[model samples]
Target: MDFIFFDADGRYFNFLCLYQILYKPVILTIFSAMQTMRWAFMLCTISQLDVLIYNFENMKELVKAGNCEINEAFKDGFKKNIVHHCAIIQFVNTIGRAFGGQILLFFMINSFIICTTAVQFFSIPNPLNNIMELVWIFGFLFIMIIMLYIDCYFGTIITEKGSQISMTVYCFPWIDLKQDLKKQFIIFFVRNQQDLVINASKLIPVSMTTFRKVMNWTYKGFAVLNQMRK
Candidate 1:
């Protein structure tokens, strides 16, 4: 029930009243923007997971096929799976962001609610009332920065390292734990991966034209995606 600048004007008026009047719409606008961000993250997560599952399934099938039948594209696919697995880590990181942002949003909404009630005690407020505002506004920002950094940088590294384990542990229950299919899958995957390396080894003397074409295709795809993001 603390307040600030309650001196003159018979102390009937409170600064918080003006503050709320001016701040509510702005806070609501930010809340709306956060909702949009949340939705976008959800859709983005779904899209990434869908692509990952699709590509992983396709690559798994290619690996299940014998090496003699594997093609260069399928070899590229094996490489792509590693990248996709890495991407899954990133998508999971996005989940952390989505969750953390919602937490922040809750804090924001709570702050707004506090603002509404804050003036109620203005009549019997202490001289330190203004300090409450500064504490919430500034302290909350500091907490948010730490939250985002920890979730993005620190959590990503941990999750990326754990991703292989997560893939195995989490999916083991769904997969047939029998010996036959397990042996077949490992043998098939390893044989194909090694064969791909062997095939690639033989093609190390790639033609300059093929190398340039690959470089061009990669650059073009990167540019397109970058542009789309922009």
Candidate 2:
């Protein structure tokens, strides 16, 4: 009777363990899906900007080659490009407003996670004996770093492409254009002189510079943790 009761208890414990093991994968799957969606949205926005940049470049080339005729139709095209540019900036601003808070939160959480994980991994006395543990921790760290990098990389691309628009317009042979067209070109040039940048919560500009700062903070945090452990 005692043996039977012990076996029954062991079986119940095993069932609970199995349930937990199965549940974790489901949660990870949901998280992975969400990350995929976020990346897809970012890529879509980048592609739209790329298309607009291409249009601007093409127009610049035509103007430079003296193929562009400065007439009413040309004026219309110039105005249209300016409107399109403004529309894209507005769209980017909308995205920034919508996801700015979430982006800031992500950066904070990832920085903390990276610092803590690095400290814990480095603090282990015998990593060879704990190969599986090391691999799991390393994988988590790598994923966080990659995710943060993707966000910053995309932001840098946006800034570079945006600034290119001003350069393209500036290179156009505006001196040969009619008085009115030259004035329009000057306005466009001045307007685009400010590079487009996406900000996090209207505070932090999301760029490679921000990425470097985050890494610096992460290192500082890791150093502090190590000192505390010692």
State each model's CA lDDT, in order.
Answer: 0.44, 0.80
What would the per-residue lDDT of candidate 1 be over residues 1-230, giving only the tens digit for each residue?
33454654644565666775768788979866864564465445445555655664554465456442334434455456556655655664555544554544443444343333333323233647577765665565455433333323332333233333334323322243345545644553443231101011223211233334434544465455545545
CA error at residue 22 for candidate 1, angstroms: 4.4
lDDT, candidate 1, at 139:
63
Model 2 lDDT per residue over 36-150, tens place: 7656766766787777777766766665577866454357567777888898899778868977887899899999999999998898789999999999999989999999998
Q: Among all windows of ten consecutive residues in candidate 2, which has the lowest summed lDDT?
A: 1-10
Off by over 4 Å in 2: 1-23, 63-68, 71-73
